[model samples]
Target: MNERMTKQPKAIQAIIFDLDGVLTDTAWYHYRAWKALADELAVPFTEQDNEQLKGVDRLNSLRWIAQKGGLALSTAEEARLMAQKNAHYLELIQHMSPADLYPGVQPLFAAIKAKGWKIGLASASKNAAFVLDRLGIAGDFNYVADANQVQNSKPDPEVFLLAASGLGVAPAHCIGVEDAVAGIEAICAAGMRPVGIGEPARLVQASLVVPQIAALSIAQLQALA
Candidate 1:
C-alpha cells in the first residue's frame, strides 16, 4: 500500500499494533513450534536463536529454522515443514483466551479510544483475525491488515502502510507499536512513529521504547506526537 501522505500530517490520530509479540505472547507459541521442528532436525535451538524469527513470515521462519541445522530444503520439503510447524502452532494457540492477551492491552485500547485515536493491527500472521477473535478484541481494532493482503512483510512497510490506509489516517499521524526491530523499521519506513515494546537496547530505533505494553503510558504516547 502507498504511504505517501498528500495532506499535511497531524498529531497521533491512530495506533497500529503488531500481533504476536505486541498484543500477545504468541511469539512463545511460535518459538515452541519452531523448537519442535529444530529438535526433530537435531538443530540446536534456544530462545535467543528464536529471536531472529520475530516479525518474519512463515516461510522465512522456516528458512531460519532449517538454516540452523545447515539443511537445504526443496520446494516440496519446505512447504511440508512449514505446514507442520503451522499445525503445531495452531494446536498450541488453541487454548488462548483473553487472559492470554498481554497486560494493558484492554486498557491501552480504551485509552487510545478516549484520545479519539483509531486503532488497527498490522500483524504478519495470516491468523491475525483468528487471534484477535480468540482474544475477544476483534471489534476493538478499526482495521486489521491481513498478512495475506500485503505483498511484502515487516521491514518492507507494505502492511503498516495498509493499516494506515484502512484507518483513513496518514502514516505520519500514527504510532506503530511493535516488539521487533523489523516491525519498528516497517513503521519508520511507513512514516509512522514507532513505540517499541521491548528492551531499549533491542529497539533503540523507536521513537519511544517501553519494557512492555503496560509500561507504555498515554503520557508517553502523547509525547510521540
Candidate 2:
C-alpha cells in the first residue's frame, strides 16, 4: 500500500475534482465516441480499450486507439478523426442540462462550498469548460485546470498542481477526488491527499476511498483533513 493509505488527515482547505468519471457520467459518452471513430477507421477496439484511455486527453486517447490497432494515422487524418469525435460528443452532450447532474454532485458541491473551502476542477479533457457549462455547474468552481492548459496529463501531476496553484492553495492543504489510477497517482505526486471514487481495493493508493460522491460528507472531509 502507498504511504497515504496508512492514514487520513483531519483538515482540508481545497478540493480538486476529476471531471469525467468523478463529476459526471460523460465517461460513457467519450467511450462511445472513441469506439465509433475506431469502427469508422476499421480499427479494432473494445470497452477494455476505453479503460486505457481513461484520464488521458482527447488527442492522446485517439492516438492510443490508433496505436493499439496498428493504424498509423497522418496528422491530417488524426485531426479529422478528432474533429469528428468532438462533433459527436457535442451533440450527445446537448441533451445534458443541470438536471443531468450526477447523483450527490449538487449536494456535495454545495456542502463543500458552504464550508468556505476552495473548489477547483482538474480534468484531462479540453472540453471540460463546455461540459461544466452545459451542466450548469461551471460557476461552482473557482479554478479549472484542463488539458489545454497543461503540458502534461494525469500521472504527471501537472494538471493537479496547476489547479492547486490557480486556487492559491498549497498541495498539502488540498484533497483531490479522482476515479482513475493515473489521476490518483498524479494527486499523490502533487503532494496532496487523494480520495478515490471507486472500490477501495482498486484505489489502494488513495488516502481515502469512497464508492461514490454521496458517500463523502462535509464532516467526514473535515475529519480527514
Question: Which candidate's TM-score is highest?
Answer: 1
Residue 69, model 1, lDDT: 80
- Model 2: residue 219 alpha-carbon error in angstroms: 2.4
Q: Once superposed on the true structure, which residue ranges of model 2 sit more than 4 Å away at CA?
A: 1-11
Per-residue lDDT of model 1, residues 54-78, tens digit only? 8999988888888878999999999
**Global CA lDDT of candidate 1, please?**
0.90
lDDT of each: 0.90, 0.89
Candidate 2 per-residue lDDT over residues 116-154, each given as its tens digit: 999999999989999999899999999999998999989
What is the Cα-based TM-score of model 2? 0.92
For model 2, which pairs clash?
9-224, 9-225, 10-224, 10-225, 11-225
lDDT of 2 at 155: 90
Per-model TM-score on C-alpha atoms:
0.93, 0.92
Clash pairs, model 1 backbone: none
